[model samples]
Target: MANSDSGASSNNYSFKVVLLGEGCVGKTSVVLRYVEDKFNERHLTTLQASFLNKKLNIAGRRINLAIWDTAGQERFHALGPIYYRMSNGAILVYDITDEDSFQKVKNWVKELKKMLGSDICLVIAGNKIDLEKQRNVPIEEAEEYAKTVGAKHFQTSAKLNKGIEEMFLDLSQRMIERAQENDLQKASELGRSSSMRRNVVVVDDEQAAETSTSKLTCCGSTT
Candidate 1:
């Protein structure tokens, strides 16, 4: 899974990260910035979930991110759980300029936790950071909510690409560490199972040897 060309030992860690929030919250914009390093100003509402891929190296681990941009309208909410299930992590986005969008973050978090479990890594991203004059959700308030839910918080401007890469990079590092920890746990369990099997085989061999020796001794004594 390591990328040989990067000169650093890179393991290809496939991680799914979904964006959830109310409509027009710049979910797709944030994803496009992270995946393509480009931004579009004419915002279009997302109909279905859109997927994008990006590769990066974090602490020598090659992480491949599968970004899912889900439609935030109420009608499309039924598909929300399906997207959440496939995600190892999530970036819950809200427009900094819109209070209603920001308020819906709690709902998104609730649904995600209900479907994906509390262990799933979640990041609360306050989008449109560039629109400071129109900002309705204060940074402090948004960050406090993020802390309350145990999710990382970021203020990003997709149009400006500010904090976009950093957010994804942070997620990548966390995902890589999680994957490594899980791998180590599995390896340790396998090693223990193998050792137990070996011990059983050795005990059986010793018991068989003792039985053979006992039979020989009996025969010799009788003769």
Candidate 2:
């Protein structure tokens, strides 16, 4: 388990992740729980969006995560793709007690795929899981849908803080891994570029030396 709040370092990497789902499904609540570790019973619905910055360590490397909590109303859905464009990962959430909200998870996924591509890292959350008595979406069904869309699924209770930390931690870890791999690839590319530049410099130096030697020989013959 990596520390979630370690400060960034020279070896640290950062990435952006966004949360998308139907309105009132507790996307803001989940992010508030994960980033602040506090819940507000009277929090207002998110309007445009909110941003939170968190640091995480994965496999001994520090990584920074910028989380975007997006508004989920149908009217706000138009803005979802912009967030998706800049995100390296996403969390799709829905209310467990609302069948319509649960169904909208598929729509969110579809939009994300259409805009961001299928390989985007994603987690599917069934929120308000504490209201099991009122659950209109079955656990198996949600799990199946998550699997179908290749997203990780979890049941969470933002009110009780159940599964809240775990969900974000899991998503953070996945994002960290992706960031680490990306950093490694970039470092390799830079190394190759540097080596190629050095080779070019060496070749230029050799050519310059040859040209100087030829000039000297021609002057000597003329003299």
Candidate 3:
């Protein structure tokens, strides 16, 4: 088989993805839904920011995703660049019931583009589908904005655990493809080897257990 000749050609990719939205809009809930595979109705408002790390093996490539959840309060807005700098992707989330949150998501997308340029894999998520009856942001309108900004839009419900995985998986896959393209471009420009470095994998037993049971939070400071 032609696949046999490919051997075990595996490259590991570590991607940083930030979740940006207003407080009480379920940004933390969405992160927990993806990383812990559980939902909490009484989740406290996140003060500053935190992150969670998950590893996935896709087509012999190990993708280590660090999902950062940022505080959407305007006071903490200044700290955004601290987390999103060097990020490979970002998910601009908004509450379906809160029109204001959608507006905030728009501002975020604009800022990200101005600062990070067009390469940051972007996605817009209209969250809280479980409360669809209360939705104030129309799906068509959000989809149109997403298309205008060159990003994919998804309707998600952290409470019901809908569309959470698909959003993350799609973003991760896109990041991988983008990385491959950049690698190819650099190789052509520099006339250097097109090979990628091996990604070191390490996980301690206690850390792994904690990640499963504890809140999905990671690298960032509290306000």
Greater TM-score among 2 and 3 belongs to 3
TM per candidate comes to 0.81, 0.76, 0.81
Q: What lDDT does candidate 3 reach at residue 180?
A: 74
- Tens digit of lDDT per residue, candidate 1, span 1-223? 2112222133666788888999999998888877777788798789978888888766666667778889999999888878778577889999998999988899988887887675578899999888999999989999998999989999999888899888988877776665666666667899999989888844588899999999999999999
Tell me, by lDDT, which candidate is best: 3
Clashes of 3: 1
* lDDT (Cα, tens digit) per residue for candidate 2, span 1-223: 1222322234565667788888889999988888788788885599978899987765777668888999987888777767767577888889999999888888878888887675478899999987899989999998998898888998998889998778877877776665556556667899999989888844588899999999999999999
lDDT of 3 by residue, 43-76 (tens): 6687789999988988778888888999888899
CA lDDT, candidate 2, residue 82 = 72
Alpha-carbon runs more than 4 Å astray in model 3: 1-10, 192-223
For model 1, state the Cα shift of residue 14 in Å: 1.3
Clashes in model 2: which pairs?
A: none
Error of 1 at 107 (Å): 1.6
Native-vs-model 1 lDDT? 0.81
Full candidate order by lDDT, most accurate first: 3, 1, 2
